[model samples]
Target: MPRERHGTPPVGSRPMMSIDGLGDLWDTLFGAQTDPPALLVLITGAVALVVVSTRLPWRIARNAITIAHEGGHALVALLTGRKLHGIRLHSDTSGLTLSAGRPTGPGMILTLLAGYVAPPLVGLAGAWLLGGNRITLLLWVAVALLLAMLVMIRNVFGVVSLLITGALVFAVSWYATPQVQAAFAYAGVWFLLLGGVRPVVELQRLRSRGRMPASDADQLAGLTPFPPLFWVGVFALVNLAALLAGALLLAGPFLTDAGLTL
Candidate 1:
């Protein structure tokens, strides 16, 4: 029998975190309200999502986060002189990835970092590309939603994800102005960073489950445990700084003219 977890929350029946009608009601409730600052609310909401995501009982339910982690392993394998095998994904709580080539210390570590943080940055980029005007934002959001529908019809979640990314762009577009798009962009970077580190906590859960997902390096070269702590700490600090710099680039847009003069 699968061992029960210490503090695992009751798993939700929904495949994804159903926002219910929250997204639809945004313009009416929070959008209509003043001075709590819609952007602050956005930031708060974004942070809350990340926190909630970490607490999720199943990786399948939080596929994006799992993908990010597995992607990191693939990246680390590539850098360390290896190849990706393929992905194993699920609806909310579980995943097991197969990869060829194991990361030699340095490469494996970086790949780990990659999976942790890539998603939110992807969100930020989406926001940036959508542009900040309201009509454009709404239009793009519609486009993404329609595209996501086509993806659903095709029975391809990845395709659905691709089309839905326009929604990320919509996030920045819906904000007060183009000037703050960077903030949203940075916000994505921050989301990625948080997601990446989340697995540290997940590590404990994995230990109890008696499974360690092999990365590209582990598959290709054979399983060797994740490197020692000092290296991991060094890995953490370096990635943290890199992500911060990335966030700055996002935040910088508000401060810089960045070609908006018409």
Candidate 2:
């Protein structure tokens, strides 16, 4: 990817708050070439990978299960007299276990619900949080996770909640420049919400429309028109967009003054 030259944004080269300037923050000394063509290549490559993954059936199913599984672990811990430790998401069904004694029957039931409750709530919160700059994204997510953990402090998993929050912030900070990091930060926040919030909202809407409970599978059965192909298209577009954005900036384009940008 074309990287920004290592210096403050050049005088009048671009607006500090502009998208081009923000995008330029992804500039690097690690073989970064500011040539418009190279920048376009990086954007295209990044977009393709992301879109393809999103459209995969396995990926979607696995993420769905992961959502539930996280809740399960928290719920089970609560019921079993085990301290609810923070959840760890893998690429498959959740493993709801605690670091302490096993719970009785009622405890098992609570553990199950923990997984269920977390996803939707977390998602709903995320949608509202990601509407701004990188710092806003980071702070919003951190605050949300920390607050949620605090509410569940009696659970053993509370401590790890902060750790998880820290990890995300670190990931974005380490890999991204101010602008690119901000973009990923926005996506990360939305990903949490979409995984939980959008699904629940859809479920509610479905129920209201049909006057019957929607039968979302506990297993990986949810499917819509977005297939592997859909993801490919999305990534392709993102890369194109990235190139366009870069070109516009290099050619002296102006970004909207609004504080939002990818």
Name the best candidate (by TM-score).
1
lDDT tens string, model 2, 126-236? 323322222444444554444454343333333354455556665665665656554454344334433433333333455556642322221111133333334333323
Return the lDDT, model 1, position 68: 47
Residue 5, candidate 1: alpha-carbon lDDT: 8
Best by lDDT: 1
lDDT of 1 by residue, 76-187 (tens): 4556665555444444434443444433355544554455344444444433332232334433443554353332222245444434555555655565464455355434
Clashes of 1: 27
- What lDDT, from 0 to 1, does candidate 1 have? 0.43
